[model samples]
Target: MDGSDQGLECLRLLNEIIADFDELLKEDRFRGIDKIKTVGSTYMAVVGLIPEYKIQPNDPNSVRRHMTALIEYVKAMRHSLQEINSHSYNNFMLRVGKSAFN
Candidate 1:
């Protein structure tokens, strides 16, 4: 295999990873999460961006729900990566960082 072949294989693996992540967002449990974009291999996503999913100012439960969803999404992504690694020769490591913005 030449340089171009290796590059194509990398891109193919990346596409498969991204597709798996995108599919997770389509699930009912993750409906409130939005896929902002992908920067290289980093997957960017936001929770409670949608009006319906927004956290209420006075409701602690609402905030809890939003945070829970975000955490769940992260867990799901990590799990997906593990599954991907198990099937492929590549071993992907996931690092997650979360923030809240008004």
Candidate 2:
């Protein structure tokens, strides 16, 4: 979205990327191609992996914890984005200490 942040022109282009993201997620295109999603714009992106606490059963407690962690991660990403590249432009990563299950 940083490109979108560049100006109105970039913003126009963002519509396409956002649309693509929506499609990818909706169609489960990333199911087999599952990878960490990273956004240059902190305002967008669903993050929160590396479950510190083992996820178990179908309890709301696990949901709450995961949501909390995701929220924190989102906030931190936003903050970092604001700090790093207001002048230039922005960028997630890696596949370690993690497993893929879907």
Candidate 3:
């Protein structure tokens, strides 16, 4: 399917997953990956398309950015779930196949 279709699917799935974590998060006891893992992966997939970077050999920056983004998204996911904060995971925006930012 096209990116739009896939993106919509992702949002739908994200909402479902987020809802499932409603209780675990309400008490601030968020745990496990089943519900949150897929959402993180989906975030990577969507961002990796153009502005997102992925981990690759000999690309420390890329890997670094990817990990950062992963972390931010994980944070954002929790924030939205608990109504705590907001983030776009921009920390992961890295240029692939390049070692420098310019």
Candidate 4:
């Protein structure tokens, strides 16, 4: 295998990792979550972006629900990354930062 082959292999592995993340967005639990974009290996998503899932200003429960969903999604992403790491024999770490804004 030459340099180009190794590069292709890396891209293939990255595609696999990204595809796994994309599949998570399709799950019912993550229905309202939207994939914003990916910067290199970073996966960006947002919750309550859809009108139906938007948080209600007067409803505290709505805010809690969205926050809960976001945490669960983050956990799922970490789990997915672990599975991918196991299969690829690569160690990948996830760093999560979350915030809620009006």
Candidate 5:
């Protein structure tokens, strides 16, 4: 494939990956987290950015719960991506980073 073809193919693959992530994130286990945006291969999400989180910001317990939820969501996301890449033998790996705002 030419460079243009390869770029399009990469985008197509990324779209498929994003679709899978979208479906998985819809599960009840991922509530309160929202998809921010996808930049190239990077996927970003925000936790405690919803209405429920507005009331949770002042509570330490709520902060801890949000942290736990974020961690669990990352774990599931990595697992989901692993499963999807394994099928195509692409050996694709996903790295996660987390930041909390006060």
Candidate 6:
């Protein structure tokens, strides 16, 4: 494909991916994670920020549970993004950055 054609194809794929993200965010599965804002092409989220972080450093069980939940959430999100890329036949990669505070 030519330059313009490639650009158009990417745009089309992006539109579809955005729609998928919108639907995913509306689901109840990701209740704790809140969508802060989309900066440029990045989607930012906070896991238990307003209500304070639930994991306590002293409690190993609490920390383990929260960590497990975060891992599951990230895996699900990554799978969804990978599915979108596969369906679109595009090699779009997602870069995720995570930070946790006690």
Which candidate gets the maximum TM-score versus the true structure? 1
Among residues 3 or more apart in sequence or in different chains, the pairs in candidate 5 whose N, CA or C atoms overlap within 3 Å are: none
lDDT of 2 by residue, 12-88 (tens): 54544444444443333222222255464322333233354444448877666655655444444344444434433
Q: Show where candidate 2 strays beyond 4 Å.
A: 1-52, 87-101
Best by lDDT: 1
All candidates: CA RMSD in angstroms? Answer: 1.2, 11.8, 14.7, 1.5, 2.0, 3.1
Which residue runs of candidate 4 sit more than 4 Å off their true CA positions? 99-102
- Predictions in order: lDDT: 0.88, 0.43, 0.43, 0.85, 0.81, 0.68
Identify the superior model by lDDT, candidate 1 or candidate 3: 1
Query: Which residue runs does candidate 5 get wrong by more than 4 Å?
Result: 1-5
Q: Write the per-residue lDDT of candidate 4 for residues 16-96, one digit (tens) a residue.
A: 878988998888988878888998877888888888888777899987887788888889989998998898889988888
Descending-TM-score candidate ranking: 1, 4, 5, 6, 2, 3
Per-residue lDDT of 3-71 in model 5, one digit per residue for the tens?
Answer: 999888778778888888788778887787889999988898888888866427569998788778888
Q: How far off is residue 19 in model 5, in Å?
A: 1.2
TM-score-wise, the better of 1 and 3 is 1
Give the per-residue lDDT of model 1 (tens digit) for 23-89: 9989898888889999999889988788888778799998788789889988998899899889886
Model 2, C-alpha of 37: deviation from truth (Å): 8.6
**Per-residue lDDT of 34-78 in model 6, one digit per residue for the tens?**
668766567776665536554466898866766665566667767
Task: Give every collision pair in model 1.
Answer: none
- Give the worst 10-residue stretch by lDDT in candidate 6: 47-56
For model 3, residues 1-102, the per-residue Cα lDDT tens digits are 999998996676556544644444343222211232333534222223232233464888766665566455466565454442223322322222212332
Q: Give the per-residue Cα lDDT of candidate 1 at 70.
A: 83
Q: Is candidate 2 or candidate 4 better by TM-score?
A: 4
lDDT of 4: 0.85
